[model samples]
Target: MPFLRNAWYVAAWSSDVSQTEPLQRTLLGESIVLYRDSLGRPVALANRCPHRFAPMDGGRVRGDALECPYHGLRFDRTGRCVHNPHGDGRIPAAARVASYEVEERYGAVWIWMGEPERVAVTPLPAFDYLDPQENETSTGYLLTRANFQLSADNLLDLSHFQFLHPDTLGSNQMASGTMTFDEVGETVWSRRVCRGEQLQEFVANAYGVPPGMAVDRWLNVRWDVPGLMSIEVGVAPSGIPREFGRMSYSGHFLTPETETSTHYFFAFGLPKAMGEAARTLVEYAVDGLMTPFKEEDLPMLEAQQCALGDQDFWQARPVLLSIDGAAIRARRIMDRKIATEQLEQQARIEQCEAEQGGKTPMPELTAVPIDCSALAR
Candidate 1:
């Protein structure tokens, strides 16, 4: 599975990277080291040192630079080697590592893994609800030994909740809900609304609803490019407006670590306007909601991966279902974007080669763009 490289991927929670120690993580199959500079800004660089190809994470931070453990070579935030403790103290021009564009926002450190020039045009997806100052938030991470798309598919289709998370997050009414799919700009949305259903105990407690009370429940998920999703779940008294009821918003950001593994970064947040009581509910939401995901979803996704084993998802010939519409739409959107990017990259390479008097001339690429206007909302 070719990844969409020209995009922002969450490398880690802002709290995960520190000024004292380098945090190493694999994103899009590349080893990256993240740390804060002396001025308290995050920096991301290739984890391997050019000299001897040693891992740079083993080194210690010295001011705004990282001192290589294998040798005393020091690299600054821009990935340029500032000092070479070896003979003559003359730093080789090729001693530096690749410096990645990084931005800290929405409580996470986002890294751009594609062309540095493209970073100016590409904007990070806004996740304002995750701001800690305005919302009571809880974050959790889990490494899944499954393809990132598979995990994303699980979220796009909520029907599985009825069977996979019966006790914690699902109910019989959920499967019978009316589902609708649409597109808003570049975002794909999947919405399920279950009316006149008995509130599950876990949900009732989170929303402070009376147990067993029949309410209108909604599960709305919006997906952006490169596996970023925001899920809005709420329940309200029958025939009542949703704003008058309790709602919780959660962000599910998935970054592929490899073809067969993913880095799942998820966070739950509730408006502080819901009062101090909402803070307590946010804690319960984390513990109560994460139970099914950690115990049930994780195992199922991993087992599914083991079953597929190096085979492409479509090659496995999955049976089609109405519930799979949203996931399939997203998969197609991703496919088109990746294909377009690859073509553009090839065109650039060929143009460069042609400039150098290569035999092959640069071919004009007529890539097909994704048309979502028909489904636009």
Candidate 2:
């Protein structure tokens, strides 16, 4: 299974792609363009025109078809050129480009690069809060130099927040909480309510919680298909979930560019009663402080990814802790999925061979999703 080839990966925010036509993006290194069709369904296609090899994203949208800017060749969402200005009477049936399946959810556009026939939108992780009326949320997108896996690893761990994002969302006490992990329904949920004396002091100063009130900082990691992690964090009194202020924080990793570079999509939700004042404050803090903190993490991951080769690449465990279990389990699950996908691919090859009799040929493969073993070591 391709790490991101089959899953519903967000390409862009809804507002960014609604204007003119197909929006182009590089997920897992293949350039794809996304657009809404006549039936108002979103679809993706290989961004290049096979004829002259021009980018289809540069083309204009003419009704349902996206017209190539170079030759005025128009191809529909299925990547078929219905109208060719230079053609005699009819366009050749062979003149077409690769089209992909796309779906829009949670204010983002998702594309499928694997077998479009096998893509199922039902099992996709849906953000239910986006549908409800009581949530006040905003989406933020950023490109990072760190490996996607590093970011995934970072998000699953709440222990690093004290050092990484200390000023905004971290407390020295919560960083050393007794975390518990449980796996259910293809997802790993882990959480710990902070109780350290330092954390209690920080909470008292920040939120005016009583000195006796212990904060339950719950963090849930829903690993939707292997590498894609949906993280939710909430802070409430030791036993109460209702006092949760920041209700949700979800982050997703797009297919990597050069293995070390990644695009991160984030959806943060707070109570609507928090008002515009709170929203503006959050935005300002995230942009000014959080972004720079993320930038600080970039060099660490980049150096780690770079040191993998030419040195001892996965021959030893450098250093680890109990807190790494969340990331460890996440990797184990991904490894299993990748192995299953490889087995299925092999089975299909054998089946095709049995049909035609004799030598079996490997089918065309798209992106290489994730190499799970690398994370284990």
Best by lDDT: 1
Give the alpha-carbon lDDT of every model.
0.86, 0.65
**Which pairs of residues collide in candidate 1?**
none
lDDT (10s digit) by residue, model 2, range 287-336: 55345446656666667767764333235465778888777777677667
Query: What is the Å distance of residue 58 in model 1 from its true position?
Result: 0.8
Q: Which 10 successive residues of model 1 have the least lDDT summed?
A: 368-377
lDDT tens digits by residue: candidate 1, 201-293: 887777778977788988999999889999999889888998887778889999999999999999887788879876787678777867788
Backbone N/Cα/C clashes per model:
0, 2
Give candidate 1 misplaced runs (Cα > 4 Å): 359-377
